[model samples]
Target: MTDQSAPDERGAPRLTTREAAELLGVKPETVYAYVSRGQLSSARAAGGRGSTFDADEVRALARRSGRRDTSPAGSDLAFRTGITLIEGDRCFFRGVDATELARRYSYEEVAEWLWTGELRPGARFTAAAGTLAAARRTVGALPAHSGSTDRLRVAVTAAAATDPLRFDLSPEAVLSSARSLIPTLVGALPTLGDPEEAGGGSLARELWSRLTAEPADAPSLAVLNAALALLIDHDLAASTLAARVAASARAHPYAVVSAGLGVLEGPLHGAASGLAHRMLREAVDRGSAVPVVADHLRTGRRVPGLGHRLYRGEDPRATALFALLEDVPQAAGALAAAREVVGTTARHAPLHANIDLALAVLSVSRGMPADAGETVFAVSRTAGWIAHALEEYGERPLRIRPSGQYTGPRPPQPLPGLRTTP
Candidate 1:
């Protein structure tokens, strides 16, 4: 039980190291170890003292020490999901190692496996004629300089408008829409590659054509395909959360994806790879990451893609991508630049390379623009958003809503003008 007497800033009593240690049945130092391993989050105690853990979070962690965390009846904020599990700095999709899935299957296959339990070999997703046409028509009207995600937002809404059965929330209906909508989003982008390859075939190939005019080689396409599979989901990310909220409110599948796209536009989320892309490109141009890394640090900017909040070590996605890039001769310089970036930044703080740096390597080597990574992320993560929507559709409608904790001034205060109306 938590002490109700001393509430922390979050309106609940916070746990000290000793309390958390006792709760977890571990030594005080072990509590800090969990913090470092990203198993738990901590903050400084009041008055700049030692660390403090959220009482509810600590209890939740303790209960889930063996498996995944599950909230009690009243803890509506804690949720349950079976899609993606991030354990021991590794990512798994449906209990299968994600990197392995990325290796053995294509993006469509992995997405299919996530949506359904079965993996269909050589699965192909084709956009509907009407949906693709509508999305293309809508995206064409966007400003010339609009980012890929902006075009995607417009395309999804238009795609939804074209579908008469979009409101059907049944499993089969949602699945059909997902299969069509994903490719439709890719088809909406103006072709930068062979027009023949624009609408279908490999999703990575379709997206590649849109990102740059550079020809897609086997090895490079391999890397891009794996990236899409690897990025399919990451367990209730900001965008996924938004998508789930929309689904909880009984929004249709297209609207659910639109909600996710809204959150993905944030710099800290979808645009992260764009930042890393620019940084890695500058390092490649300079022929050394030292100055570029120095410029970032000297200007008080983070060396983009250097770290992730979830992993205490190298992000597994980065490790997988870097291994694949090693086989591509075109990626050597950009890959080296990425290494130097890690080495340079590690000197001041031991932040390891994250997926953004790996994505930067791909975009820089492939001649894709800075925003190219954002497009890859949006298209890839669409599957995940769909999966979340599917899950939310099974739950009671609007059950995810949380009541606000009122902290504002009491209502009925005198008006600013204090005018007495007759």
Candidate 2:
């Protein structure tokens, strides 16, 4: 229980100078020094004791002295924040280089690295592994031959329904959510078995494992796992931003995750990969992909799988995904061909493939069903969305209200007992 009597008029509790100094981990005299420095406000004690300071003041001082402060270095924006930057050339997760981990480690290791900032080369899952298994059973009950996108939509929504504790955003809870959800969603893929066995490892690992049905070869599984890890997160994309915004409103993790799903339901974001797939399917049906692409360019004048709003030259993620797609037969030739066609026609357009286009190529090359590309995209983006949501939840409340520019009449005036003619 908290002390109610200590609070002043505004409900902010007043702390004695000793207590304030204790909170700030300084000497009692240092509290007086802080008052002299204009950093703290002090009041004369009620019963003729020394001065007392507001608890809020003491709390602020404690926050200011914390080891890992995230107050913005410099920005005019209200919530200027030090975004966790994962450098990619030498490749870092948070701050540690990921290339070393990626080369020698598994997707599970990478996920741990991303969430904890510490590279646990050998972390055992005990209870989390069991939770993942349960989630897989729930996913396996889903219709196997269902459209990948629809299945994902159904499964995620349903799984979220069963999870009552997703509202808690504690590190352990959120991490558990990630571990459980990734496997469950990934395990729900059609080829990953039905309620009986599923595959080897977690959902992300299982999905990667099933990507190559060639008797569970080690190298293939590793490549697939690497792909999943590489695709897991990106900076604040639209869906991720939506999730973060939802989280900022103190929405539950499930609701925040659902917000990402809602954004992904939009054609311009999550469905973009599906659109790219359809465009390819249309090109293939017409016998020659290049000519068909050229004709579409001539008519629509808009290239489907090229150009990005952010990257003027080339999307770095697209480049990375293309590199990962190199050995996969489903992606190898077709992606190169599509890139060539897009490059030739959209020369002036300067269109560069975004992450969606690259994922589409990878999905198609791997013989994943048409909707698999979108399913994978949604699953991958959720990681980033959850990360951003966690970040938003750590900060002060945000105010994102909408106001109209008012292109209409100022205010409606009531007629005085007479009807007006148009």
What lDDT does each candidate get? 0.87, 0.60
- What lDDT tens digits, residue by residue, belong to model 1 across residues 1-422? 22222467658787888888888776777677667545578887666667888888788677656322232222234456779989799999999999999988999999999998788999999999988988888899988999899999999999999999999999999999999999999989988877876644789888889988888888998999999999999987899999999998899999999999999999999999999999999999989999999999899998899888779999999999999999999999999999999998889999999999999999999999999989999999999999989887887677665566679999899778866999
Q: Give the TM-score of candidate 1.
A: 0.83
The CA lDDT at 112 in model 2 is: 72
Q: Mind giving the per-residue lDDT tens digits that candidate 2 earns over 110-203?
A: 6676666666876523324444455556656766565566656555666676678977878778877776666656655556323333454544
Query: Clashing pairs in model 2?
Result: 91-98, 183-203, 307-351, 307-352, 330-365, 331-365
Estimated TM-score for each candidate: 0.83, 0.67
> Model 1, poorest ten-residue lDDT window?
67-76
Query: Pick by lDDT: which candidate is best?
Result: 1
Residue 326 lDDT, candidate 2, scale 0-100: 66
Model 2 TM-score? 0.67
Q: What are the runs in model 1 whose C-alpha is more than 4 Å off?
A: 1-75, 415-422
Model 2 segments beyond 4 Å from truth? Answer: 1-105, 122-146, 192-197, 208-223, 281-288, 346-348, 402-404, 415-422
